[model samples]
Target: MSDEPERQIKALTGALMEVYETLRLICLHLPVPIQLPRGPEYDLNTLVPAVSRLIEIIGDQPMREDEQSLVWGSALNWTAAAKLYSRYLLTGGDFVSRLELELLIQTAGEGLIIYLDGPDSTTQE
Candidate 1:
């Protein structure tokens, strides 16, 4: 039981980390700075497309119906990751800090909450 939750958490964390790494790689290839937002006006216009392409590259095989969900889900996960990454960079945290990793994992959990709750549900709001 406890192990089940732990394993699930680990799996989700790994997925988020993978997404983060992929986003980093994609960012490296791009020309923009893609800095973290400073306030509530944080727009995801650039990140959404980059993350969508990354998810497609990473999970587009076999063409399953679930892959569609995965693509969009990864986009959402990357959006959250960008938020935390920006915070880390702005605060002068180390590039690979454990705190940043933990924030990415937590953001992934929030993405899961959004997925499970559906687009219209206000449970997380």
Candidate 2:
């Protein structure tokens, strides 16, 4: 019983890492001098669904109202990040800029660490 939360957190962390890797790969391979979207068909709309899926995968439990809000906020941040990346790509910015990409990856990795290590109410203090 005591191990359940730990196991769940571990699984969530793994899933997040997988998603982050996919995002990193996309960023790496996105064409240089990106073709900017001219219509609704090729907009950043796709990122919203991805962010929702990520939140669904990482956070599936019922939560207090406040916690639910916080989760939604985090999801929004993820969505915004995706949109920003898309914009950067569309503007012909270097998609594989080493410094920026490294920072993004490092931030995601640190986030995974925090998610894994954060205190769980189910665990003993």
Candidate 3:
């Protein structure tokens, strides 16, 4: 949301149009054959949209227990996990919120995508 171009982040779910575009720019500038921390696995095609959807869904609350678990395992009771805003509440909040944030970050890292060399270089997602 910040107006400063250097610090704006639109990587989370349902990222603003600007943010998504920024992500593409970042990927384009990365060293050819983007390498992730976990592995070299990368896909430019579905990476952006997948990460966006995951963040949007996880950040939105009142989600079913199953949904939360799918996002990330629930270490504690989902019923008492509190609201989504609670992620910053209670002095950094509980495990669930923290877990969601961690998972989101991990997904961002997993977003290593290929840079298209030409029109025929990239595949449809």
- C-alpha lDDT score of every prediction, in listed order: 0.49, 0.44, 0.34
Q: By summed lDDT, which 10 consecutive residues of candidate 3 come out lowest?
A: 73-82
Q: Write the per-residue lDDT of candidate 3 for residues 14-113, one digit (tens) a residue.
A: 2322233434444334333222112134332344334444344443445444333333222111112223323334354455655564454444323322
Instruction: Give per-residue CA lDDT, model 2, range 26-106, as digits (tens).
Output: 233323211222322333465457555645543444444333334334454545545545554456435354235334434
> Model 2 residue 69 lDDT?
39
Per-candidate TM vs. native? 0.32, 0.36, 0.25
What RMSD, rounded to one decimal, does every model reach?
Answer: 13.6, 16.1, 15.8
* Residue pairs in clash, model 2: none
lDDT of 1 at 93: 48
Residue-level lDDT tens digits of model 1 in 50-91 = 555655554434443443353346456566665655554456
Residue ranges of candidate 1 with Cα displaced over 4 Å? 1-45, 48-63, 94-125
The residue ranges of model 3 lying beyond 4 angstroms of the native Cα positions read 1-86, 89-91, 113-125
Whose lDDT is higher: candidate 2's or candidate 3's? 2
Q: How many backbone clashes does candidate 1 have?
A: 0
State residue 113's C-alpha deviation in candidate 3, in Å: 5.3
